[model samples]
Target: MKYEKALLLVLAVTMTIITELDLLPQIHRMGFYCGDPKLSHDYIGDTVTARYLLLISFFIPFLILIDKNLYQSSFSTYLLMYITFIIGYCLCISSVNFFKILFGEPRPHFFDTCKPVEALKCTPGSYVSTFTCTNSDLRRARDSTKSFPSGHSALSTFSAGFVLLYISNKASDWKRIVQVLCIAWILSCTVTRIFDHRHHWWDVLSGIVYGMGLAVITLR
Candidate 1:
C-alpha cells in the first residue's frame, strides 16, 4: 500500500507540473462574437490570488486535521491522512486543468486579455476565431482562452468539502463551526470568480460539482 500510494503521488505531481506549464494538448480555439458584452469585462485581478487560495486550502485543513488528531492519533497515522489529502488535491487540480484545455471556454475578461486583432473588423454576432492577441504578455493571453472549469472554484470547493466531510465523521464540539467556515469559504470563492470576471456562472457551477464529487470520492 505504501508503494502504491507513493507511485500515485508521483504521477499526480507530474501531471500537476505539466498542467501548470501548459504543456498539455492545445486549448480549443473557441470563437467569440464581436462586441459581446459577456467577454468585455476588464481584467482587474483576482480577489483571491491562486497562491493565496492554495495556501489556505492546504493549511486550513491541515491545521484542522492536526488539531483534531493531536491527542488521539499517532504521528504516522496523521502523516498518512495528510498524504491522502494531498493526493486528492493534486488529482482535483490536474483533472480541472485538463477540462479547461478541452473546453477552452473564454474567460469573462477575454476581450481584455486577448484583445483580438480582428475585434475591429469582425461583424457583430459573427464568430471570429482567426485572430491574434494584441496583449504583449503571452502567458496571460494564452490563459484567457482556457477558462472552462474554474480552477479556483474546484480547488476551493474540494478543500472545503473534504474538510467538512472529515469534520462530520468526528464527534468534536467544534465540528459545526468548522463546517460553517468551510461552507463560507467555498461560497466566497464562487462569488469572487463571478465578481472578478474570471468565470461564468455555469463554469463555476460545473467546477463546484466536480470538486464536490472528488471530495466525496476521496473521503470514501
Candidate 2:
C-alpha cells in the first residue's frame, strides 16, 4: 500500500514535470489572426492562487476524512482512505495536464504572454499557422499554448466533488449544507476561470464534467 501510494505520487509529479519541461510534442497547434481580440486579454494574477487551491484541496477533505473515519475505523483504514483520496487527486491533475498539452488551446491572454514575432508580418484578417513567440520568458510563452481544459477548474471541482461523494455516503445533518457549498465552490471555480481570462466557457464546462466523472469513478 505504501508502494502504491509512492507510485501514484511519483506518477503525478512526473506528469507535471513533463508538462512543465515541454517534453511532449504540442502537436495540436491553434491558429490566430494578427490582431485577434480573443487573445488580447491582460494577464491579471489568479484570484485563487495555486498554493491556496492545493491547500484547500488537500486539507479540507483530509480533515473531513479524519472526522468521518477516525472514530469507527482503525488507523490503517483511515490511512488507506487518505491514500485513495490522494491517488484520485493525482490522477485528476495528471489527466488535466495531459489534455492541456494534447489540445494546445491558446489562453485569452495568449498574445500578451507569447508576443509572437510574426504578428506584424501576418495580414490582419488572415489566419496564421506559423509564428514564433518573441517573449523572453520561454516558459510563459510555452504555457500560453496550453489553455484547453482549465486545470484550476478541474482540480477544484474534483476536490469538491470528492468530498461531496465521501460525505454523501454517510448520513449527517451537515451533509446537505456541505453538498450545497461544494456545488457552489465548483461554480465559483468555473466562473473565475472565465473572468480571469484564463479559459473559455466550454473549457470550464469540459473541466467540470471531467472532474465530476473522475470523482464518481474514484469513489465508486
Candidate 3:
C-alpha cells in the first residue's frame, strides 16, 4: 500500500510535467490551434473544466480503497480495484506520453503561444523552440510534446468502466440506472477535455477506446 501511494504520486507528477512542457510546442504547429468549434471556449471553458476534473480524478483510487465491498467480496473485484487500476493507469499514461513523443500531435492550445501556419511540420529534433529538460529538472511550461491521447479521458473512463462492470453485475435496477448515469458522467468528463482546449476529438476518442478496452480486458 505504501509503495502504491509512492508510485502513484511519482507517476502523477511526472505526467503533469510531461503534458505541460514537452507537448505544448508540437501542438502549436497544427491546425486551428484549439479544440472543436461547438463546445468552444465559451460555455465549455477550458480552465474550469480541466482543473476540477483533473483534481477530482486523483481521489478515485483512494475512494476505491475505502470501499470494503469492492475487494472483500470477490477475487475479480479485488483485482479490479488494485492490480488493474495500477496497471491500467500506468500503461495508459505511459502509452500516451510515449506515443505523443513518437507521434508528436500538436495540442489545441498551441494557438495561444504560437502561430500555426497551413500544413505546418516540426522537424523531429529541431523544433521551433529549443529547450533542455530532464526528469528531475522538469519545467511545467516546457511540456511541448504531449497531445496524442487525453490522460484525463483515459483515467475517467477507466474508473467509470470499472464501476460500470460492478454495477452491471448487481441485482438492483435503480443502482444499475445510477451506474449508467455515472458512465455518462465519465463520457462527459472526456468531452470536457475538448472544451478545455487540451485535446482533439481523435485524442479523446483514442482515450475512450483505451479505457473501454481496459475495462473489458480487466473484467474478463
Candidate 4:
C-alpha cells in the first residue's frame, strides 16, 4: 500500500473510534452562543436569492477545478482525488441521512412546528404522521431530521479541500497563502451553517473534521 493510504486507514479508524466514544463533546463546547437557526425555507422558492446564488457561485469554480484536474490532468494524484470524491459523496450523504433517521433529533424550528413529541421512535406512523414544521419544512422532515452532521458543510468542505490539495501540489508561488485561504473558506462555510442556525456547532465541526480527514486520507 502507498504510505499515504496506510495513513488514511489509520485516520479513518481513529475517527470511528473517537466519535463512538463521544470524545468531541469533552473537547469542544457549543459555540459563540446559541442562536436561533430557523430560516424561512421560503427563500428556496426564489432561486435568485443571495443564499442560493452565493452557494452556486462558490461551487461552480470549484467544480471547474475538479474537472480540470480530475480526469483531464496528467497527475496520478488527480485520479485518486477524483475517485475519492465520488466515493466520499456517497458516503457523506448516506451516513448523514442514516444517522438522522436513527436519531430524529428535532429540527431548529422543532418547537414552533413539531407536533407534541411522540414516542421518539421511528415507527411507520411516526414516519408518516408524527412531527412536522410549517411550510416546506414540514414537507421535508427527513432532511431536517438528521442535523448532527452538516451535509452542506461536508460537501463544500470536500470541494474546497480537494481543490486546495490539488493547488497545494500544483501551485508554484504563494502555495501556503492559497492553502490558508482555503482553510479559511472552509471555516467560513462551517460558520455560515451555524450563523444561519441551520445546524449546531457540533454538526458543522463534524463535517469539517470529516471533510478534511477524508480528503487528506483518501486522496493523499
Best by TM-score: 1
Instruction: Report lDDT (CA) for all predictions.
Output: 0.84, 0.78, 0.55, 0.50
Q: Write the per-residue lDDT of candidate 3 for residues 11-128, one digit (tens) a residue.
A: 7557656654445334331223223332122222354354565455544544433344544576666654655455555555555666665665556544332223321454433333
lDDT of 4 by residue, 23-52 (tens): 433221121112223422221221133354
Overlapping backbone residue pairs in candidate 4 total: 1
Candidate 1 off by > 4 Å: 66-73
Please give, for residues 1-220, the per-residue lDDT of candidate 1 as tens digits: 9999999899988888899778887657788989999999999899989988888888767646536543245767667777888899999989998988887878999999988999988888888877788999988998898788988889999999988877666676667777888898898888899999999998999889999899999867
Candidates' TM-scores? Answer: 0.93, 0.86, 0.58, 0.54
Give the CA lDDT, 0 to 100, for residue 189 in model 4. 68
Give me the runs in candidate 2 sitting further than 4 Å from their true place.
Answer: 1-10, 20-25, 63-76
Candidate ordering by lDDT (highest first): 1, 2, 3, 4
Query: Which regions of candidate 4 deviate over 4 angstroms?
Result: 1-80, 115-138, 169-171, 174-181
Model 4 worst lDDT run, 10 consecutive residues? 26-35
Worst 10 residues of 2 by lDDT: 63-72
Give lDDT: candidate 1, residue 2. Answer: 94
